[model samples]
Target: MTQLADQRPIAAAQEAAVDPAVNSSSTTTSAAELEQLRRARPRGPHRRSPLAQVGVRLALALVAVVALAPVAFLVSLSVRSTDDVLTGSWLPGGFGELAWGNWSAAFRTIPLAHMLANSWLVALGSALVTAVVAVPGAYVTARAGKRGARLSAALLAGYCAPPVVAVLPLFFLLKEVGLTNSVVGLALVNGLANAPVAVWLLDSFVRRVPVELEEAAWLDGLSVAGGLRRIVLPLIAPGLVAALLVCTFLAYGEFLFAVSFAQTTASQPLTVGLSLFQGDRTVQFGQQAAAALVGVVPVYVLAVVAQRWLVGGLSQGALK
Candidate 1:
């Protein structure tokens, strides 16, 4: 009986150990099954109903139509005759009725070629100047720590001040320097005006460059300028392109300064020259539209070409 009792206890212990191992095995299997089921479950896209997908697509289509409507109208109006435009037709007339002569007439009526050349010079020059000034300023400010922050803040303050407030002062200064009514003068003014914005934009891009790369260059005996040229410029090429395009667009579309400063046809840009289509009695709507279209083409082309870089640069800066 004693031997039997000992044997019973031994059996009980073995069963206990076996029960735990079995339980553990079952639990692990259950956990793995649960994980598998989770992975197999339908995701977000699969959960969306056909109706919901249709609704989303329809909403996007509607938004696109609404946004493009004005542009379509402007293009249609540009190709129409004055009579057709005056008749308030929303849709353009027949192909035969299209006033192709309006384009020729628009250029002939004003010094369109000269104005275009002047605008290009001012826009490109301002963009170049802004890039030259802003890149150095941004690099210096970004590397200067707290001093850089203070300097950047000061620039922002200057930029925040209304341009109109300083227009008269700037005009007088340009007049004194014999730069008034000249494309070069307008470019310089535009460049100065946009310098702060360029700095703000480039500051973000400059700071994004890895300090390790610059430090490596320094260790190799590269000067700051050399480091920037070798390491920084290539990295920030997109940001530079974005900034240049923005500066060009701003200078190209600038009407207030062009009108205020450039009085003569010889120096007038397209923005000011477009106003020549306006008569004291009645506006030549078709011809004005044609001129406006001509002026907008270059900007539109630039926007399309640099759109990816522009969006990426702006978003990257904003995120930083």
Candidate 2:
């Protein structure tokens, strides 16, 4: 009986140890499952539902199609014959007969080379010259005393004055001196008309440059002009680009003044060249379309090139 009792305790101890391992294993498995559940739970922000995702994708596709439609039309129209256009056909009846001769018709009708050259001279001259005069004027306006504010306000008021109202006086003034038909005279008018706009834009831009920067340059033995040339010029480049683009585009697209002033095809800008096709006999739609396109291409190219500078120039002045 003593031996059996001793054996019973030993057996009990062994069983207790085995039972603990089983219980611990079960607990550990449960804990692991709980941890996985916590990890798999959704985070704080709302989830993108399936419906919302599908709707977003559909909206993007629709917008893309809409945007691409015009480009598709232009490309198609440029190649199509008059019959294809008149019939409202989507594609030319024949695919291989795409006529590129319309572009030649456009060139011949509009005096494209002469207009292009004139437009380039006027646009480039106005932009570069405007930048030269406007930058200094803007710097002065920004740095001027309280008296300068009154002057600037007056100038801004004049800028808002109607160009139509000023045109009569301008026409007479140029006509009086026999400058009405002159390229230099036209450039002067363009520059003057555009200067006020440049002044306002550059004034705002100049105000944003930190005063401390100039002072540091001054302390380093640089003159005011030197400091401005080195520091201010580089920083204000975007504004200059933006301002130049605006001036050039306005000058290039100017029809009223060019119509009134330019008598000879030699002096006429691109804007007026397109109108010469309207003879009493007939209207050349193909030529008209071509000329319209030629006039637009240069302006489009100008805007595209200056787009980055324009964004920067417009924004920088606003914040400061």
Candidate 3:
């Protein structure tokens, strides 16, 4: 009887080893392990309900429409007759009645092609100047620690001051240098004025470049300048391009200095040339709109071409 009792206990032990149900501890351990694995698994973005998705899409569409309303109006105005434009019609009268001659008239009234060339020259020069000044400034500032902060503050302080404050001084300076009433003069002024903004933008990008790369270059026998040229500059090209585009846009739309500096048609940009559409007694609204549309084309094309780089450059360091 004692031997039978001992055999019964041995059989129970064997059953517990073979069957998980017979061993609660083993079952509990497996469940705990599974729970831990479930906790460790990364979660995906929360799935929105169909209704929520529709609402979000609709909101985006609405914002797009609102933002594009002015552009749509401009397009309509470009095709409208002088009378229709004067009447302030929201839409053009009819497709058949669209004044296609306004485009030709605009080209004839102003030296549109020449003004466009001048604008391009000024804008490009301004961008070049901004890059030349800002790139180095940004680099120096990025690595300068507290001194950089002070320098950046001073630069931005200059930026914060109204453009009007410097207009007289700049004009006189340009006049003394014989740059007044010239595209080159205008470009130089715009470029200098935009340098602060470029510096601010480019500093972020320069900071994004890893210091280890520069150290590696140094170990490879490259100087600071050489490393900047071959290593840092290439990595920050997108930011440089973005800064150039921003400066170009700013210079292109600058009217106060363009009007103040460029007195003759030879030196005037598209911004100044647009005034030619207005007369003492009459305004060529359709023609002006047509010319404005022409001016918008280059800017639009640039924005589209550089949109990706611009966004990336601007968005860097935002998260950190």
Candidate 4:
């Protein structure tokens, strides 16, 4: 009896030692499995690297720096004195040395008021004239293709024509007609030069207008011209504004032939007035930059105003 009881206790102990859970706790995995588990365990959070992220951010910073450089230089030059501008580098170590006399004398050297009026007259006049001529031409061309479209395209070509090509002939023609160098003469020239583009713009726009509106108007005994003036013109006023803005900007910045056509400050535009600052020896970069910035204001204003029309006009043509 004593021997049997001791044997039973030993057998129970051996069975507990051979259990799967006890074996797994100490060393379940084989040598190869243990090696793989040790290798697979992550050493750190940076499994790869953030180099690509750093590179993208760096590239964006470079672009921003490049873009801001010119604008910053321009502003800096504008505020600095002429001596600082001429003697000092493009960058000034100090801000106090800037010469502000150019801005102060800008009005005196030229009849700035008169020049502004001339610029407005040329730009606004050309834009208005272009809208008038182009709108009808574009409408007809877009509504009636092939023949009318060709005619419209031919006119658009004139806008693309070199100013030099037109300048001599236009001058001679105007002189022969006794209209040379006059405000009226310049206005007419600007108007004629910009009209073709207007026609082309209006042509495509008119096609987007629903035919039902025109048919109803025609049934009411309104002639095509009358309908265009009343219904079509009103509907496309946004596009007209956009066209006016584009032509005005072109006319305002025009250089090549405007200089040739204009003679004195009495009739000369701002563009010409600004050019007088570039002396034979010293170019007043500060004053030039300031003046250029001043000119840019009107363009910015016109662009903002015109953009309001663009969205609605585009939506009407596209979404509808």
Candidate 5:
């Protein structure tokens, strides 16, 4: 009986151990099954509720309307009759009564074609000059150490000084050289004015490029300028495009310098030409609106065309 009792306890212990093993096996099987089921389950498309979708769409529509309202008003004013404008009517009179003559009058009253040509020349020249000055400046600033940083800061400070402060001095200096009332002189001045911003922008872009890449080129017997031309330029093409666009827009839209420097139609840009619509006693609102619309077209077109590059360039160095 003692032997039998000992045998019973041994059997009980074996069963206990076996039971835990069986339970663990079952638990693991169940967990694995659960995981498999989760994987096999179908995931439907994410969908907003109908009401939520409507609300979101409506909010977007409202934003569009608010943003476009000013542009719509400008268009309406440009096409409206002079009588309607003089009578202070905020709304259009009629589609049939629209004054197409306002556009023609604007062209006749101002040398619109000449002004536009001059503006284009200045804008293009400024962009070219800014690129020339800024690319080198940015390269030096980005590669050099503390001295480059100090120089960059000085350039920015010069840009931040009110343009009016330098206008008189620049005018007198140009006058001495017989460059006053000349498109070339105006473009050069615009280029210099915009160079600081161009340098700052290009500096940011250049810093994003790895210095090791440039060093590797040096090891391969490439000069610094060669490396910059072949490698750095291609890598930062988007940034260059953005810089040129910004410089062109700045020079194109500049009013203070254009008005001060351009004394005659020969050198006058569109911004200065727009002022001719204003008489001593009265302003031609309809003709001015038409001219304003013409002025806005190029910027609008550029924004539409280069939006992708602009966004990409602006967003560079934002992430690791």
Candidate 6:
């Protein structure tokens, strides 16, 4: 045993002679080398130089300012007096002295509250209709492979065509059904018009869903519809919300169809009702701007509220 112990020291010495790093402790030496390697590694692409980062930030700030300039101008117009509007000054006067009566004047000129309600109804209806048509269609197309691609292309091609071409046909169709000059009628038209867009938006989202999930669902005794409802719908909810919001915005801003279908104050949405601000003799510029600003509020609020889902839906298929 004594000789064996003496030989252990000899073995240790030989090992230390061969590898000095292992003489102290292998773990400690390996950790040190790892740290050194980490320090020597190159920075990632996102780690920009200070000057380059500053320039990029400045450029982004400039773009944001340019994009928001029109909205700021619209706000300025909304607060202007009739005389200031006629003068065409960017700002009516000192900010504190600017007229605040335009908002009230807009409400007075037309049933602004009622028009806003009509617009909301149409927008909500259009979104609902779009979701109903788009979700099933998108899912089917996404799973259909090349045939689905052709169908999606065809739908988008129809969307690319001018809405004007179908205006007369749509008008006659609605009239035949006794739906002309009604908000419901207008909502139906807008919903069908925007369905193609919604389907296109949702196709990628549906495709991102793994076939394995549906296969598992089937193993669990779920039918195709059950799998869609139980698994796919929940997974693609963000995309659905995004598509609905887009359809709502499209319906809200729709003009040609709104003008043709909804003629009365009860049925007319904000887009068509805004025309009342224009007279044969002159335009009620301040009132128009005020109403326009009011009309814009819902859009902004929706964007802010749904910001997360919107971004998520858009980027759903980007990474995974």
Task: Compare the candidates by TM-score and give the number of the best one.
Answer: 6
Give a tens-digit lDDT track for model 5, residues 1-320.
99999899899777867799876887899999999999887765355668877898999999989967877787888888777988988878788889888899989889888888899999999999998899889989978867877888889988998999988999998899998899988888999999998887888778778989999999999999999998888887888888888899999999898888889889999999888888898888778888888878777788779988877877773432
Writing each residue's lDDT as its tens digit, candidate 4 over 1-320 gives 99999899788767768886765655745766899998999766455358866877899999979956766777777777677776768776665665666575666555766877788888887776777667777787877768987888787776787778888888888788876766556767787787776676666667767778988999999999988889898877766766666678778887665677777667677788779778999777667777766676666677667777756654554442
Clashing pairs in 5: none
List of clashing residue pairs for candidate 6: none
Worst-scoring 10-residue span by lDDT in model 1: 67-76
Candidate 2 deviant stretches above 4 angstroms: 1-101, 145-154, 175-179, 215-227, 280-282
Per-residue accuracy of model 3 over 1-320 as CA lDDT, tens digit each: 99999899899889998887769887899999999999887765466668878998999999989967766777787778888887866888788989889989999999999999999999999988888889889999888977996898799898998888888888899989999899999989999899999998888778888899999999999999998889989988878887888889999999989998899899999999898888999888888888888888878888888889788767763533
C-alpha lDDT (0 to 100) for residue 103 of candidate 5: 92
The alpha-carbon deviation from the true structure for residue 251 of candidate 3, after best TM-score superposition, in angstroms, is 1.6
Q: Report the lDDT of model 6 for residue 262.
A: 82
Compare candidates 2 and 3 on TM-score and give the better one: 3
Please list the residue runs of candidate 5 whose C-alpha ends up more than 4 Å from where it truly belongs after superposition.
1-63, 317-320
Candidate 2's displacement at residue 209, Å, is 2.1
Cα lDDT, all candidates: 0.86, 0.77, 0.87, 0.73, 0.86, 0.88
- Model 4, residue 88: distance off in Å is 7.5
Q: Number of backbone collisions per candidate, in order?
A: 0, 0, 0, 9, 0, 0
**Error in Å for residue 261 of model 4:** 1.6
Query: TM-score of model 3 relative to the true fold?
Result: 0.84
lDDT of 3: 0.87
Give residue 223's lDDT in candidate 2 (0 to 100): 92
TM-scores for all predictions: 0.79, 0.68, 0.84, 0.71, 0.80, 0.86
Better of 4 and 5 by TM-score: 5
- The TM-score of candidate 6 is 0.86
Q: Please identify model 1 stretches exceeding 4 Å from their true place.
A: 1-56, 81-89, 92-100
